[model samples]
Target: MDTMRDRFAPVVSRILDEDPRVAVVLAEIGLVPFLEAQRRHPDRVINVGIREQLLVGAGAGLALAGMRPVLHTFASFLVERPFEQVKLDFGHQGLGGVLVSAGASYDVSGGGFTHMAPGDVALLDTLDGWSVQVPGHPDEAEVLLRQAIGAGDERVYVRLSVQANREALPVDGQHLLTVREGRRGVVVAVGPLLDQVLAATEGLDVSVLYATTVRPFDAAGLRRAVGASAADVVLVEPYLAGTSTGAANDALADVPHRVLGLGVGRRELRRYGSVDEHVAAHGLDAASLRERISGFLDVGVPGVPA
Candidate 1:
């Protein structure tokens, strides 16, 4: 199965073909797949070399010129390195564009800390009116990408990752989909981590909520889920830990609730390990998540002691 980044090139290519208003700006991160798209539309598919800031600036400039720009790069460079440009060129200017990113969290763990961007979503949260999409599957990524492109000059961030679920769930770019119904508690799984969350919470009496579009977080959906289940919520995101805890808290501000944020930890792992190894190290794998989730919800696992 192709990863989310694997599906991005073709999706953007089709969008570029169908919509003349769409433009793609890159910083030479994943340029091989887009070589054909760039060949087809030289004016629209732009490669600004390794200059991350310039890539964002060019995208903003295109947006200013009445084109919907789709900027792509490694998440670290796309959001972190060029954040100032993103803040000024787009946010401060009151312009809009789609920032599509690869190398989610620690997908490129061997590439070292410089390539990983677990804090991308958290950093974007500092800005206002930015719609963030973390698609669990390639199909969902395509859906969210198209939705972002079609969203009429709204600032959208399409976060693509190497990690993917076994299957794709229906995502409408807004609202959360309840995967499993239970009364113990609610586990909100964001993007690619849905499968792990599902595996971890197996047999546990807790509602599972799948979230592909995180920003403009489904407050209503969360509230509805909490209304049916216990107010204890566990947010399992693929990015930085606690990234959406605030959003969840705000969603349930009126009610008394408990939220446990789970994701990549703040401390950097010095060793370069495989993705699976990193997942285990960060305590994000199914086994670890099971222990943590069950502990937080005060539930007993079948073979584990209470």
Candidate 2:
């Protein structure tokens, strides 16, 4: 199966080769994919040793120097560790570029909590006007990447995770896609969780909206889906447990609505295991998702109708 990471190298290479104005900033991790690009374009493909802060700083510098820089590394190192640089260098300085992050949440399960970054998307939320994309498949990732690159002078964050759907899918636009329609409620499936969401909602009477570009939140589309219903939204993100909860609330704030935020749970699972094991532990498997969705829809949780 071709994971999102597998699709990254070629996209970056294409951008680097085709767009002379583009550059690739890398830390020590995840550099194997872009080795050929580095060999070819030594000036553009820069690996600043093991310095995460420098990675962002160099990218910011590159951006300031009239080059669109694409920073790459594991999610934890790329975002969490060098956040200060990302904030001041990119946000404060008003510089725009692309940040390609790998190993979302517990992707490197055996690498332990130090390597986990479930809160990456949530962190990006703190910034102002960042284009965030969580692609569910390799095809979607490539399309979104091309779009993001095409989106010049805008700060974009392309989240690359291990989890992916069966086939590569395309987005109609930059907004939420209505995969399936229903009247009861709406299930917002963010990125790779589409297949799982589909499997979970097989016989249910709920609308399913897939989101690749989640930063803008696509509130108008969400309202349309809710129609005359209670505006019950279930956000199934591949990142932190309730990363997109605020987005959901903001989207449905105008109407009477309730939300059940689900993803990798908040509680830290200290045990070490495989990625699949970690996923199940967080109640992200198909069975757990189905049960939760059914429960949220069937029962009257804390508020709303029974």
Candidate 3:
């Protein structure tokens, strides 16, 4: 019953009431809930108008002043527009906060390029120890968020997208959770793409590993997931294509492996269409992913049956 938007307000409110060191910075995104938060805790909740740079700047200042800031905005504005601030303010200053972003990758397809930011996670990855989380379900989002907040001053990026999974899979730790087993290869599902990836590989011989946390890439867990199989790994992410390629390569350095990366398409589509159309174009939908991944497992996976 808890949508990501609905769950966020209560979490922010609870943090404001329970932790005096917490502050929520807004850039005119969630107006109503944020306004109520402002009313409840006037000083702690800050609305910095439409200035994304200032939004992050204020958060950095807040952190410098001994406050754990939570900055909310679209992915583009929060990360792309104010990237310098994110790098200099948080990374250089050695300050940390929570960055809860909506509209992951092409989720805002109708809004076009200005609103779409598939490269946000990659940009943050270049900075420092940013804990990136892509929760598949709203229930998962809530659980992951509370865990992120529990780590004070840990830079956490929670990417929230429109699509969600059928249900919340059991997730107790940051390590990968295997939902289904197979004999050929392993499919690592990141964030909201779990359901779609599951659908894509339903009839295939591939182990599915669900991960809510992307940053601090669980290499050991990934190795465990690969096990003694062919080590054929397909990382299905919801962000930019090949965003986690480096991490994946680093994770399986010791093992001789064949990996496939899938996510948002790199090509620019000028036309404004439905989200489903965009999703299909990016090769993120079940059918497209099934085709590509099937090909990978069929030809690329060694000693594995198609």
Q: Which of the numbered candidates is closest to the native, going by highest TM-score? A: 1
What TM-score does candidate 1 get on C-alpha atoms?
Answer: 0.97
Model 3 regions more than 4 Å off: 299-306
User: Candidate 2 residues 25-128, lDDT tens each?
Assistant: 88877788889998999999999999999999999999999999999899999889999999999999999989999888888988999899998989888999
Q: Give candidate 2's error at residue 41 in angstroms.
A: 1.1
lDDT of 3 at 191: 77
- Candidate 1 lDDT (Cα, 0 to 1): 0.93
Q: Where does candidate 2 clash, by residue pair?
A: none
Candidate 3, residues 213-300, lDDT tens digits: the string is: 8888888888888875457889898878888778878888888888888987778888858777888888888888888888888733
The C-alpha stretches of model 2 lying farther than 4 A from their native spots are 299-306
| Candidate 3: 10-residue stretch with minimal lDDT | 297-306
Output the lDDT of residue 170, model 2.
64
Q: What's the TM-score of every candidate structure? A: 0.97, 0.95, 0.94
Candidate 2 vs candidate 3, lDDT winner: 2
Best by lDDT: 1
* Per-model root-mean-square deviation over C-alphas: 1.3, 3.2, 2.6
Q: Check candidate 1 and list the clashing pairs.
A: none
Summarize candidate 1's per-residue lDDT along 1-306 as a digit string, tens digits. 988888899998999999999999988887889889889899999999999999999999999999999999999999999999999999999999999999999988988999999999999999999999999999999899999999998999999988999999989999999999988899999999999999999889899999998998999999999994339999999989999999999999988899999999999899979999999999999999999999999876578653
